[model samples]
Target: MNANLQRVIVLSLLILLMAATRSHVFSHFTPVPDASWAVFFIGGFYLRNWSRWAFPLLMVLAVAIDYAVITNQGMSFWSHYCVSPGYWFLVPAHLAMWVGGFWLRRNYSGASVASLARLAFSFVAATALCHLLAQGGFYWLSNSVAEPTFAGWAKNYGDWFAPYLQGTAMFVTLAALAQVVGEQISRHAHPFARRMKH
Candidate 1:
């Protein structure tokens, strides 16, 4: 396939995955877990060349999905609990995830132990930064907290960090496995195609 066509296919799949899994209500009714974070990360890795348009597109999609869900629940989008001044901070928070994948792509050499280590480190670092910006913005600026303090923020971050990390890691790992399998198949297929052409 043409490289651009492959990118479009990947981008479409990522968007579909995000849309399908982003809503808590949707996920609650379905077996699929939220793949929003993974979508951004994978998008950064595979669609980095199109980041200028793709990132903003995904961000808009995310906000639009949130709006739909909140309004569908009979709540005004602006009046919803999750929609606050701090909600806009999600831009930076999610950018961190994108950057992580971008970094990984830049450093990725192949499917090797060293590359896998880099992937682990980059992903965890990105997840940590993303969570800090997201949780800090909510704790300090959202007004949802009655008595926000450093200690309270620390505890809140601690409570949610593991689950978010685990979830993102699970999806990323699955993507990694799929990529390896695809590469192996392509490698075998290319040799056969070349022989057939001769």
Candidate 2:
């Protein structure tokens, strides 16, 4: 299979997994295990420039899933939970994750301890930034909060940070493992294929 096609398939699966979390299909489950945080980062890591377009496409899917879930469940689309102005902030937040992945991909070294350390730092920073943008955006800008305040926002951020971070890290770890395995397989296959060709 073509590498690009393989990448597209993998990224599409990631996006679909993330979007499913927001859809009626999986709405009953808690958001703590959502794959969205890793989706953007992994998309950027693999898709590179393709992610610039893919990120927004996934965002649209998320909104569409929410809309479907809302209407299916007999709720007003306009007034669905967290479907407020602050929700738009997710664009930049996810983009931040994407950008972090792009940067990591660019600086990616082979799997040395130092390289793994860099990947870890990048993952944490990106997830934290995404959480802050999303959490802070909702607290400050959403109509859901009648009287938003810094103190209140700070508390909310503290409360939500752990689960969100955990979900992101979980997905990222899985992705990293897949990436390593794929590279190793390709690395081993190259030498074997060459011998056969000769």
Candidate 3:
């Protein structure tokens, strides 16, 4: 397949998988692992400028899926989300993540060790920023919770930090590794392709 078509298909699948992760798909799993954060990073990394509209569009899809889950799970449409007006802040929260990957996309130098380091740093930094913005925003701004104090919020942030970090790390690392492997395969395949042609 053509590169553009391949990108489209890959991006589409990533978005769908991430979006569905929030729904009833794996609700039974503890903490319910989701790829929401990873999707943003992957989009920025892979889609680059092509992600201009896709980011916002994916955000909407995520919200819609959230609503679907809440309604189906028999909770108030908006209230069940544990969100308040502040939930809208997810836009900028995820934007930071997307920009991180976009930055990496510009700077990444293939499968070199430096490239891996860059991806690792960018992934961790993006996930941290995204988490702080999201969790911190919710703590201070969400009406669903009773007036959370700084200490309380800090404690909450600490409590949730490990899991979020683990999840983001897991997905981003796997993705980066996969990309490296793919690059290696392609690099090696070219010679084989030429030989086959001969």
Candidate 4:
């Protein structure tokens, strides 16, 4: 019934949901968009203290999930080399998302709803940056594997841009909802769970 405990539980569920959706819902039926960054954003805001540990920890888990899924797809670990160019940009892109979370923490308040909206906006901006960088990375990297012409590479990047945009939009929307869900859980906790002041 502790507020802190409640926040942890809600965040864990969000991370799990994002993971499952990433592998199942998005990989299959429709592009669910990678909402995992939203989980990291929540984790960043959930704690009032050090993100040096929390942000990196969350990122590690996400990478593990990516590795697990990619391995299951029949790619060898070393085969990651094949996509090194794309992964290079992806690393910074993801780090940007976590960094965005850290930035939003400056204005976070458990007692206010608009705080959630602010968080969502920060995430959207970060996601957009991620998409742009990732697209360029993939285009540049994938060329070595297939040796596409410049036009071909540009077309390839353009083709996949929609999915990234959709995923970013979904992530932002879900993150806003997750904030309310976190707040509601906090509300039901014991007396020690008073909303932290800004």
Candidate 5:
């Protein structure tokens, strides 16, 4: 099989796995564990050649799956997801995550200290952005037409911060686990890395 195709298939499977694990295996109160970040960062670390397309594809698939499941539950997720003004900003927040992973690939070969620092920094920034975007989305959905007063925005944003922080912290822990697992998987996938041992 072509290497890029393999990466895509692997990524697709991992995304599906993450979705299943998120929706079914995990409890509702628990934030979804992000094992897919392993696939994502590995795409950057091992399949750097495929990162451009693969990362976006995986992210979109994850989002679509989540939306589908939420809609199936007959909640107001349609407006909660689509009509919210924060979605305008949320898309870029998500895109930035993939971009950060791709940027990590450009700078790191998975072996250098400074490069590792860059990757770590990217992860931190992306995690923080995800938290803020999620909170913003919730705020917009809850207060769609309210006047954008300082106090109003403040209260909205502040009200969101607690849950947002809790979820983001959980996600950060998952991201760390995924990153470590991804690096290991990348090492195993590389023919050169395998050959070097012999």
Candidate 6:
């Protein structure tokens, strides 16, 4: 397949995955955790060359999904609890994840212990930065908190940080495993295919 075509197919799949799992829109039918964070990370790794368009497209899709879900629940988009001035901070937060993946792609040198270490470090750093921006914005600027203080923010950040990191890590780990398996299958299949052709 053409490289561009492959990228397009991958991007489409990522978009579909994000749309399907971003919220409880279909929770009654099937419960699935949100894949938004992992989608952005994977997108950054696989579609980095198309970031000029891909990132914004994914960001818009995320906001659109949130809007649909909130409105579907019979709540106004702006009036929803999650929608606040700080909600816009998600742009930077998610961008951090994308940047992390981009860095990982740049440093990736195939399957090796060093590469695995880089992956772990990159993901943890990115998740930490993402949580900082997202949670800090929500806590300090959202007005949802009553009399916010540094202590309160610290507590709030600490409370949710681990869960968010764990969730993102879970999806990212699964994606990494899938990529490794796909590469292995492709590597083994190509030789067989060529031999059959000969």
TM-score of each candidate structure, all chains considered together = 0.94, 0.90, 0.90, 0.67, 0.60, 0.91
How much lDDT does candidate 1 score? 0.87
Candidate 2: tens digits of C-alpha lDDT, residues 1-198: 787898789777886677666453334357457777788899888888676577778778777876787788888888876777888888889888988888899999666678688889988898889989988888888787999888988889998888778877888888898878978998899999999999
Q: Which model scores highest in lDDT?
A: 1
Mind giving the per-residue lDDT tens digits that candidate 5 earns over 138-182?
465545546566577567667655554454345444554665787
Q: For candidate 1, what is the TM-score?
A: 0.94
Residue 44 error for model 6, in Å?
0.4
Which is superior by lDDT, 4 or 5?
Answer: 4
- Clash number for model 5? 0
Worst 10 residues of 2 by lDDT: 22-31
lDDT of each: 0.87, 0.80, 0.81, 0.65, 0.58, 0.86
Each candidate's number of clashing pairs is: 0, 0, 0, 0, 0, 0
Q: What TM-score does candidate 2 reach?
A: 0.90
Off by over 4 Å in 4: 1-3, 24-31, 47-50, 80-82, 109-120, 143-159, 181-198
What ordering of candidates by TM-score runs from best to worst?
Answer: 1, 6, 3, 2, 4, 5
Runs in model 1 lying further than 4 Å from the true structure: 25-31
Ranking according to lDDT, highest score first: 1, 6, 3, 2, 4, 5
Candidate 5 achieves a global lDDT of 0.58
For residue 180, model 3's alpha carbon misses the true position, in angstroms, by 1.2
- Candidate 5 error regions (>4 Å): 21-28, 31-48, 80-83, 141-198
Q: For model 4, how does the per-residue alpha-carbon lDDT over 1-198 read when each residue is reduced to its tens digit?
A: 686686677567756866776565226346455666556555555643646665666667766776777788788744654356576676677667666776787876774668757765887777667666766686676545466577876676577766665765675566667667867876686445555431
Error of 3 at 28 (Å): 9.2
Give the worst 10-residue stretch by lDDT in candidate 3. Answer: 23-32
Model 2 whole-model lDDT (C-alpha atoms): 0.80
Q: After superposing candidate 3, which stretches have Cα over 4 Å from the reference? A: 24-32
